[model samples]
Target: MEAPHSIISIISSLLHIYILVLVIRVVLDLVAVFARSWRPTGPVLLLANLVYSLTDPPLRFLRRRIPALTLGSFGIDLSFLALWFGIVIVQYLLAILSGLL
Candidate 1:
């Protein structure tokens, strides 16, 4: 059987990769919003579309179930941040549990 530390290492690595993907998706969306005038064409558009397609399903579901917070005129996407933090917390918990095991 594989060692427990090795299993935890693998899980941690996967979680890190998942977080990186989420961060990339967030960054792309921010860029798309800020650079609206710059047309996303060819490979750039394809990459942006791919990221959105992959990330949007869970985000959309969370957004609907979670309430949006209003800060004066602007509303903040609490769900997005919550999801990001939730993932981090879960990763930390897994790491701690793995250490104990």
Candidate 2:
């Protein structure tokens, strides 16, 4: 029981951290949209690439199924929001399974 609980706890924590990384990715992307001329270099570029690698696969899957919403000149990508909610739901389920809820 302890072993399973510990594993669930670890997974829940990792999912939470991934959500935070996704948020950072979103912020960076928004900044990039506004400041098109400001290109990331060195560490910033590396970080951006890292975030993309971690996030892209799942997002691409969602993007294929659900296109972004466009309003006039602005567009909103719903993949991130969807992923965030999915992660949270999974975390909640894990918590319940572990009897932490």
Candidate 3:
């Protein structure tokens, strides 16, 4: 018989995928910052919009609750970092409970 996957394993896997998605969203936003003039066309724009829709909720929530990192005229949104940290901590705790780490 094949070994069955545990619920913790599935949850951990989903967490990992979500982490990647969140990171991609942040990286896309950062690149857009530098290349503001470039605009995506066709399906590219659709994909970008999809990512924006998925990632915006948590970012907006954190942005409202936490102050951003800033120096002089420039400011960096730390919500992405906060979200990533929070996800990793939960993943870590779950792994510990599952005895996978």
Candidate 4:
């Protein structure tokens, strides 16, 4: 029905926004590390908190089940990559369903 198509469209839009937020989270994290000041303050702090709250739950869920890959001194968090792929897959499925209806 048209209702289902509209719902899927909304969800697809939200997923796109979520993907952008996830990218910001990754960039902010790298910035924090390179800046040598892990504790952000004022507006930066607020933004950091907002990003963390939005992205942490799903990441934490995957993180708890899967550990990061450590190569010497460097470590890679697979959860972010996994979450990104998962979202893409869901978006693809939604697109297919939308096309069908």
Poorly placed runs, candidate 4 (over 4 Å): none
TM-score of each: 0.81, 0.89, 0.82, 0.90
For each candidate in the order shown, give its overall lDDT on alpha carbons: 0.82, 0.89, 0.82, 0.94
Task: Pick the winner on TM-score between candidates 3 and 4.
Answer: 4
Ranking by TM-score: 4, 2, 3, 1
The total number of steric clashes, by the backbone 3 Å criterion, in model 1 comes to: 0
- Predicted candidate 2 versus true structure: per-residue lDDT over 1-101, tens digit per residue: 58887888799889988988898898888899899998899999999999999999999999898889999998988887889889989988997888852
Instruction: Arrange candidates by lDDT, descending.
Output: 4, 2, 1, 3
Poorest lDDT segment (10 consecutive residues) of candidate 1: 1-10
Model 3 residue 86 lDDT?
93
Which stretch of 10 consecutive residues in model 3 shows the poorest summed lDDT? 1-10
Q: How much lDDT does candidate 4 score?
A: 0.94
TM-score of 3: 0.82
Per residue, candidate 3 scores C-alpha lDDT tens digits across 28-52 of 7777889998787898788788878
Q: List the residue pairs that clash in candidate 3.
A: none
Worst 10 residues of 2 by lDDT: 92-101
* Per-residue lDDT value at 89 in model 3: 98
